[model samples]
Every structure is written in C-alpha cells, then in structure tokens.
Target: MRENKSAVLNRFFSRNTFRDIIDSTDDEIYKSVILRYVKNPENKKNVELISEIYTELKKNYRNEYYYKNTLLNKLLLGVHSINTTVALTEIPISKSKADFVLINGKAIAYEIKTELDNLDRLENQINDYYKAFDHVSVITCKENLALLENKLEIINKPIGIYVLQNNGSLSIIQKPLKYSDSLDKNIIFKILRKSEYESIIMQVYGELPQVTQFKYYSECLNLFLKVDLDKVYELFIAQLKKRTKVEKELYQNVPYELKFLTYFMDLKEADYSRLNSFLYNQFGGM
Candidate 1:
C-alpha cells in the first residue's frame, strides 16, 4: 500500500538535474537511490535486482537525458579507477561542445544522440571533437544508431559508435579510429584560458611573446599555433587533469551523477557545501 515501482521511478526521474537531487543533504533523500543503482554497483545489485530497475528505465524514458545519465552511471561505476581521472561535461571546443568527455591516458569525447535529438549537427560536432580529442564516439539509442553510422560513413569520418544497450550498459559498436594528423593549433589553444596558455608557453617553449598588451592574445595564439601539437596536447591534458582535484573527501565519495556538478560546474560555495555534506556517508567511497 506504500507505493509502486513505476511511481518511484517517476519521482526519481523528476529529480533529474543536480539542483533537484541535492537540495538538502540532511534528509539523506538521494542516499538509498544512489546506493541501489550506482554505489558499489556490483556488490549492491544482483542480476535480478539490476534487471528490474533497468527494465523500468527503458520502458519509462527514451530520451537523451535518461540514456546519458545511465551510461554515465555505468562508466563511473564500472570503468573509473583511482589512477584514472573521472572528468568533464558540456566541454567547449571550437564552435561546439561535447556532451561529455573523460580523461585518463587519452581524451575521449562522447556525443549523445537520443531518439529525441536530430542529426543535423552530428558531423560538425565530431569535426570539432576529433581535432582536440584522441578518440571521439557517439552514443545513441538503437533507433538512431544505424542512421548515425550511415551518416558518419557518408561523411567519410572515423568517429566511433556505442549503442546504449537495453540493460542500461554501453557497448562499443565501432571503435573510433585514432586521429593522427596534426591538429589546428588555434583550435587547441582556444580551449585554454589566458593563464593556461601563458603557463604552457613558458614551460614547454621557454618563454611567452613580450608583445603589447593589446596584441598579447593574438601573439600568444600565433605562438601556440606554431608549437608542436603533440607537446601541446600533452600539456593540455596535464592542465585539464589538474582541475579534477576536489576536496579529498568529496573526491572520494561524490555520487557519479553529481561528481560533474560538484567539481566542474563552478557552483557557488553554498551549493558546493550542500553536496559535500553527504561525502562521509557514501557506500563505496575511496
């Protein structure tokens, strides 16, 4: 008489964005929900338990948000490691930004195409990502997978494809061929800040241009464009990875869904504190 499973799922999906989930850490409201689906995933959910929840999600939601959050959960719970840095979301590149990006040994950009999204910008998105990332993949539902694959081939691109499986796990259908050509230096440095670019120039190339303050950005861009891309990207990844350092407690215990929000979204200190309050109580932390 308490409630039904679908009712619970409906409420859960409504708690979609970061603000909805962490309004108050005192209630431990998100506590059980996270532990069941994500925390200590293997030790927490058996085959029967996993199947029940996965089935409900597929039946109830067939959009980009559901698919991406599920894939994020699986990746964070399954693929993440202490040595490897768990990373960014909606990251800007050139004219476009990737839906999510993970950094460890190499940069991998994931573009999400739900049944609800259009393919008009897929090609353009992949172009921006390939220049900056070592590997780029599109994660789509089955309905869009074939169409996306055909479009990728029509354009003669080597982007990979991963189909979100019915059971809420991601399977790599096509491996993204590693891009080996020299990247556009302007596009690469454009993703960095003034300080970041200045730091890289000083460290790797020995010095920055002592140009007029008005021309500093242009001169720096030109100098960065002239530097060897391999070395530039090495410096870029190092700089990007350094940003993932969070409060040690938060780093160890933040929810997979909230980790991006807690670390990279640049929330005000009050909101960050709200999210941090749950750190000491997480199931598989550290």
Candidate 2:
C-alpha cells in the first residue's frame, strides 16, 4: 500500500491552522475559524479541541480566566462567553500598562487587585488610569468587594466593582456611583447583550473581522447556553461601569445589527481606516 503522505500533510496543516487561528492576534481570522468550527456539526471535535486548548493554556498561566471568574462569577455570568485572556490588557499605571483595558470604539481602563494587596496602592492605581483614560474600573474578589465598595463610597467616587468567584464566574455589584449625570439606558441594555459585548470586545481587542454574521450569533447563543443569564447580567453591569465613557457620539440608540454581525465577523473601530483605504484604492479613489 502506498503511504498517504498528502493525507498526513492535510491533517497537520488543519491542526496547525486551527492552533494558529486561536493564537492569532487578528480578531477577524480568529472569528472566522471559530465560527466555522462552531457552526459545522462536523467541526465539533475541533471546537472542543480549541476549548480544551484554552483551558490548558490558562492552566499554565497563573493569570487565567479561572482567577478572574473565581472573583466575579457570582455577579457576572456572561463572562463565560468572553475569551478572558484576549479581552484583558495590561497597561502602565506609572508608565505601566493598566491591569485590563476594554477597547471597543474607545478605551476603558481597569485596575485589578486582590484582597491581600495594599488598598492605598490600588486606589492610587485607579487614579492613575483615570488620568490616562476617560473611564476607570476596579476589579476585586468577593472578599474585597464590600470593603472596596465602602471605601469608594467614602471617597465619593462610588466606582463600580467586579467580584470574581472561585468557579470562574463574575458578579458585578454596582455602588450607585455616577460619573456623569447623562446616562443612556439603551447603551446600558446594549452593553448587557452578550452579542453586543462580544462584538465590542472583538472589534477593539481582537482586531479581526472575518467571522460571519451567523457565527457571531451562534457563539453568543453558545455562551448563553452554557452560562446563566443572571450571571451574564452581572458581568454586563461590571463591564458597563468599567467602560462608562463614550468618546464618540453614537446616533443609534442600540446596536441591533451587532447581534447579526457576530455570526461571521470580528470587527473593530480602528480598522475602519484600513477598510476605507482598501475600498478607496479598490474603487480608484472615487
């Protein structure tokens, strides 16, 4: 019997491609592969592999979603759908990266700390992020939520706090703090939507836009299927508080289209310029 060299190469390339897509910084590429694997029943094995890879990678890294979910799961459940590793950004407080930044159309800063850490230092970190970015959020475990809440109330900042639980779940408990009087309920609702949240994260952080519209919705559904709505709601509240400032004016009350967009693409605002240039060039600069 002849050796199936081509078959071997095909399998190797398939697995490698899948790994590369998951590890890729390009959100579009990542989204496309993720969607394809998710939608096709035949690709279930690959999807499971990707999930396993995510879990294994996080295990190797101490700063995994496991740590984050443990502190916040009680308050925020929707986090299960988010790729925590990719969503979090470490930026400098004093020439250091903020612990975690949610970049959609704009940048939102967060400073994560444990209960054992110095409270004063954490406060200082929050101040630093506020100075650099328009909005700032503080994330802590359940043990510190009450203390942080009281402290924030005393300081009059009354910032929102994120509580990570031991089971990789999140609970977002608000402090009734208001940064500005102008609050839009629709934006808040949109933020609460899992699809919208994923879309925003993909756009700002993932930097990829190839996932199809159907796949985005499917992913959102899958996330919800595996998690609880209350948990998701809590996380949304936490995320909303963290990313409160809307730098640009949004004429649309809600991003209804975002739900469909989630299926096949991962888009970001920063890429608009590149997309525009590409289109312009393709259309002879018309």
Per-candidate TM-score against the hidden true structure: 0.71, 0.36
**Local distance difference test values of all predictions, in order:** 0.66, 0.42
**Which portions of model 2 miss their true places by more than 4 Å?**
1-65, 68-88, 175-286
- Tens-place lDDT per residue, model 1, 11-91, is 443334346535643223233444545545434422233344445467655554466566556665467764565667778
lDDT of predicted model 1: 0.66
Write down the TM-score for model 2.
0.36
Q: Candidate 2 on 125-160: residue-level lDDT in tens? A: 655555445556677767777778777766556466
**RMSD, candidate 2, Å:** 19.3
